[model samples]
Structures are given as structure tokens and as C-alpha cells.
Target: MAKRQVQTTKIDGKRVRIVTTTGANGTRVQVTEAEPKEWELQAAQVRALRGMPEYGKQFLLAGDQNSAKRGPRAQMEASAAGMTPGEADMRIYIAGGQLRMIENKVGRGRLSPAQVDRHAALARMGFTVDVLRAVTTEDAAHQAVALVRGWLAENDNQSGQGQPRCSSTACA
Candidate 1:
């Protein structure tokens, strides 16, 4: 006969354990660090972005913080992707079963045809994309949150219609 394995759900977001076997003395355990999978990271960044205080929010999409040459935005992106500082950046977020992205483009006049096609592809995979042009750190965070606020408001309005409310707090 084959032995069975025991699986355990983790309380923390970052770790999990699977018990492959047990002996007379002790149980064998395998621990896996739950680094945010790409999708989870994307979703968290989006939710963390909601209702952010106005001051630090700008760093979300552009690097304008401090006196550094690239600004907070450039710093954050470089750190997030493990890329060299000063390179351009983008981030995606998913919440309430919706997806959004923040793209820091230096210049723009509406999305290019290729960009639209790419956005459509993301949509097919269940994401709603938003792009923000971040010339600086202030640009990055502020624009990112602003986009989310608007999208969330729209989502709320759509959901509220014809829905029963438990209390006025639900409306708020």
C-alpha cells in the first residue's frame, strides 16, 4: 500500500507546510515559503493602493519623492522588479474580482494600437487595465490611486443599484 500525505493550510500569507510522512519518533515536514505568487502580488498591490493618504500616494506610479534624480516611483519599480534604477515601470492590481494596472509612460496620446491589443489580451484573462503617465514620483503614486478611486466608485455604483442594503454603512 502507498502512504498518504497530509496537507495543511497556513495562517500567514507567506508560508505553507505539507507533511509527507511520519515515523515512530517524529513526523517529517516540508515547509514552503509562500512568496506572493505573481497574481497575489498584483492583487495585493491594488488593494494596498485603495484609500491611501494623499501625501505618499504619488509614489505608487511615479518617482517624485526625496531629492533623488529618479524620484520615488523609479525607486519603487526598480526595487519591485529587481531591475536597475531609472528604468520605466508598471504594476497591476486585482480586487473585488476586478483587475487594474498602472503604467508609467513618459509620453502618450492615447494607447497605441499595440498597447490596446495588449490591454485587450489582459481583459480576456479577466483584468481591467488603466495606464497613468508618471513623469515623476508624485505622478506615480497619485495617479495610481486616483485611477483606482475612480474605478472603485464606478464599480460600487454599478453594484449598488437594485441591491438590498443591510445598513447605510454599506452604502458608505
Candidate 2:
């Protein structure tokens, strides 16, 4: 039997790396997943964000499809500990902005209020934050997007922009 090859795929945002090793039969036998904590949320957000029409194709085509990487602080520490920047967290590329820090996590992890506050701090620092839930239904994703859009919109207005309000009951 011929030996199979190992393949690496970007996790949809190049935040981390996914490696798949093939068996002798040429089928994938194992998969490895790794992501930096800070970029995890951003990656998840981008993943969820990609489901929307506005950002889907662009996000997919941006060539940044990988698992999340360590935060700037962590990466710097890692460097001091003797590692390359590539070994650091995958940077988040927001529109018209330099790559920024991001936060990502997978599964149904309940976020505490304090945690959310910390996340906000990261946001203030221009880092995108993402929280991945087990969210089993498409409706859940839709509801989440609606909620976030409304939140951002409202905040935008509060800070002085006539952003259109969402009138959907699902969002109200």
C-alpha cells in the first residue's frame, strides 16, 4: 500500500492550523486542532459572520482560514520563551485597520459578566471577541446575528449616529 500524505488547512481565518493525516488507503485517519485563546473568539465570530451575505465570500477568499493563535502578550512571552511569531496567535484583520488581537473559544462555555467585561477591554484595544456555543439550530445563529447587529446599531446611535433600528420581534 502507498503511504498517504499529511495536509494542513487554514481554519477559515488562519487563526490557527488544522492538520489532517491520511491513512494508507488515502482517507483521513486523524485530525488535529489548535487555536490561540485571544483569536479564538474572533475566528468564531468570523465563522459565524461568514454565514451572512455581507461578509461571506470576502471572508472566505481573504486567505485567512486557520485556527486562532495566541494573543499579542502571549505571543511576546512565547518569543521570550523562544518561539517565532508564526507560533503566535493568528491576527484579526478588521476592515481598514491593522491586524488586531482577537479572542475565540469553542463549545458551550458560559461566559460570566466579568469575562464579558474583560472581553470589552480587549475590544477597546481593537481586538475582536468571539464566543462559540453549541448552538444547534440555524435560528440560533440568526437570532445571535440579529442581537449583535441591534446592539451595535443601538450603541452607534447612542454615540451619535442615526443608525437604522431593527424592528424584528426576534430582535426586540
Q: Would you give me the overall lDDT of model 2?
A: 0.44
lDDT, residue 129, model 2? 51
Q: Pick by lDDT: which candidate is best?
A: 1
Please give, for residues 3-52, the per-residue lDDT of candidate 2 as tens digits. Answer: 55555566665533434455566655555554334333444555565666
Q: Where does model 1 exceed 4 Å of error?
A: 1-95, 107-117, 123-127, 161-172
Q: How would you encode candidate 1's per-residue C-alpha lDDT over 1-172 as one tens digit per residue?
A: 3354866566665446465766665666776643332223333434456446532222233221121356678868756865433221344332334434554453343555656666677778886555555433444556666666676566567666423334447334
Give all candidates' CA lDDT scores: 0.48, 0.44
